[model samples]
Structures are given as structure tokens and as C-alpha cells.
Target: MTRRNRRMARLALPRLAFLVVPAFLAGCASPPVRFYTLGAPAIATGAVPTGIVTPATPVVEVARVTLPDYLDGQDIVVRAGNQIERSATGRWASRLSLGATDLITAQLARGRTDLFVTDQPQSLPATWRLAVNISRLDVTRDGTASLEADWSIIPHDANLPILHSRAAFTQAGAAATDGDTARLTQAVLEQLAERIVAGWPR
Candidate 1:
């Protein structure tokens, strides 16, 4: 090549690299994913109160909750009127289908002192089975959270009548962050648990 052309080529090479390096680095960098759960806030071990379980107390098995196809996954969603948006960085630690059951089991155990509630498989047969199904969960970025669900208290004996009930709950709060949104979800589920425990069958 000519002397003048060679000098221009050398000058352009370094400039091109300097311009491209930052863009390459930026493209490689990605936001970290954050995980959230429906479980209640942690409490100090000694601070948690326990219930007395006698042999006579009936065992209630809490079956996993049935959720809608949209909500059964891990994505944390926000509802804006007719549209739904998924969070870019936030995700459910456990799938909602299972998480909702865990939350209900914990809440049921915490709400009552006379009943033995468990979500795990037990050697002792459960006298009653608690089933929960979710119809909808409406959550907004900064406004409110609401959910609709129906539950049944089924007896081990077919002769006994099974009680069926439905409930709708709403919680008003500021859920600007994903963590805040998870807390709001927990609050509404706790309200649903209240209704279920209140309607406990004889």
C-alpha cells in the first residue's frame, strides 16, 4: 500500500476498537434475577407460639392449591385493567401452584389451636382433606391486590357432608417494588385463610 494509505489505516484501527469495546461490554452485562415467595415473614424461633396437639385432634391434610394457567408459573404479574404485565427481574421462588398451598397450610395451622393441619404426607391417615382452588388474582403495581378462591372441607367418611365455600378478598397497599407486591399477595392469602378457618366444619 502507499505510505499515506498505510498511516490512515493504522489510525482508523485503534479508533474502531475503542468505539466497539464499550458496546460489547454493555451487551454482555445483564440484570440479576430476584426471587420472591408467598410465605409469611420470618419470625424469631422462640417467638413463634405452638399449639397443643392431642391424639383426639383431627388431622387435616392440605392439598396443593389449583391455580389458573397464567398464574401457575413463577412469573410475578401485575394486572392493569384488561392487560397483564410480567416483571422483568422478579420471579416466584416456588411455583404459585405449590406456594399457595404452603401458604394456606401455614396460615391454617397458625390460625387454629384445636386442629392439626399438615401439607406433608403423614403415616397417620388424615380425617379431613382441605382443598383450595384459585379463580383469579388481581394485582396492581401501586394500588391494590385481590383474589378469588373456593375451598372445600371434605370428610374421610362418605356419609358426612362436605362443606363448600367461596371467598373474595382485597388488600389496599403500595406495591411499587416486587418485594412489596409479594408481601401484598401474602396479605390477601392470609385474609382468605381467615375465612376458611372461620368456617371450620364440626
Candidate 2:
């Protein structure tokens, strides 16, 4: 109420306001929430043809194939070299390592003859080894999907390869979405499996 008291109150008000304003501003500011997409659905194929004779006595154990450094994760880089933003459903982000491994496993399983295939690494008493290499896997903006795979089967002792093959397959879908991509990939793998199985030695 007094003049001096009023002057002191006026000076203190600004300091209090400064502190309160910062606290309010800090509360208002928050880190943005990051979003990711759910992976696409897996494609299915018909049962593998009968009489393939996939190692009746387990003569060879198929080893897990090594994937290239690129295409190792769901961190996808678009055609323009920019990372694609993941959708709310978690599609179109990228393929996981396990996904690639599974794809190869399934392909081999369908084509396997006189060989046992597995994803786990193990030292097995087997007569042969199978190796796989994935060269390119991509889904273009135009909805065309492409896949290239190289594979070989060799005797455990000899360096010479018993069976060597390379396959490239493509499928065009209505869209470049994850669902379409998975479908196309599955189709290509199925075809490749058939080819490999047809050529496999009995």
C-alpha cells in the first residue's frame, strides 16, 4: 500500500513473470513422437511337388545363406536415396533380416532334395553344403517387383560345385505398397524354388 512497498512489488513482478514464463514454455515444448509401420503380410505358396526326395537319410545339412550388407534392415532408402517414411500400419519401411532369412529358408525347403535345411548354424556331419547369395531385391515406384538370387551346392570335401544356378524373377502389381511387395516376393521365390527343385540331383 505504501509507495516504497508498491515500487518493490513492481520490480519483483517482472522477475517472477520471467521465471514462470520459462516454466510454462518448457512444459509446452515436447519431443515429437516417432512413428513406424507394421510389416506387410507374408505370401503363401502351394505345397511343394511330391517325390522330391529331400535327403531321406539327411546326407547334407543346408546352411543359412548370408545376406548382403545392403537390404539388411527395415530402414528403407527410397529410389531417390531418401529414407521412406513409415506408415501408421508399419508398411513400406523395409524388410527385416529375419524376413530375408526366412524367405531363403522357405525357398530352399520347397526345393530341397537329399538335403536338410535349417536357419540355425551348426556343425553337422554332412556330405554337402549349400550356399546362397541374394543380389538385388527392390520394389519400384511403378509397382514392379524384382528379385535376383544365386545358389550353389558343393561337396564337403571338394571345391567344385555340384549344382550352380541363378534366377531372376519379376512381378507387377497394382501398387508399390508393402502388401504387393510381399506378394511379388513370394511369387518370385516360389518360381525360383520350382526351378531349383526341378534341377536338383536325386
Q: List TM-scores for all candidates, in order.
A: 0.81, 0.58
TM-score of 2: 0.58
* Ten residues in sequence with the least summed lDDT for candidate 1: 40-49
> What lDDT does candidate 1 reach at residue 148?
97
lDDT, candidate 2, 35-92, per-residue tens: 2333212423212323444434454444554555655555442232344333333232
Local lDDT at 126 for model 1? 84
Clashing pairs in 2: 37-90, 38-89, 38-90, 54-114, 55-114
Give Cα distance to truth, residue 168, candidate 2, Å. Answer: 1.7
For all candidates, the clash counts are 0, 5
Estimate, for each residue in 1-64, the C-alpha lDDT of model 1 and write its tens digit.
9999999999999999999999999989878889998875342211213655677878888888
Off by over 4 Å in 1: 1-24, 41-55
lDDT scores of the candidates, listed in order: 0.83, 0.56
Q: Which candidate is the best by lDDT?
A: 1
Q: With candidate 1 superimposed using the best TM-score fit, by how many Å does residue 65's alpha carbon deviate from the native? A: 0.6
For model 2, the local distance difference test gives 0.56
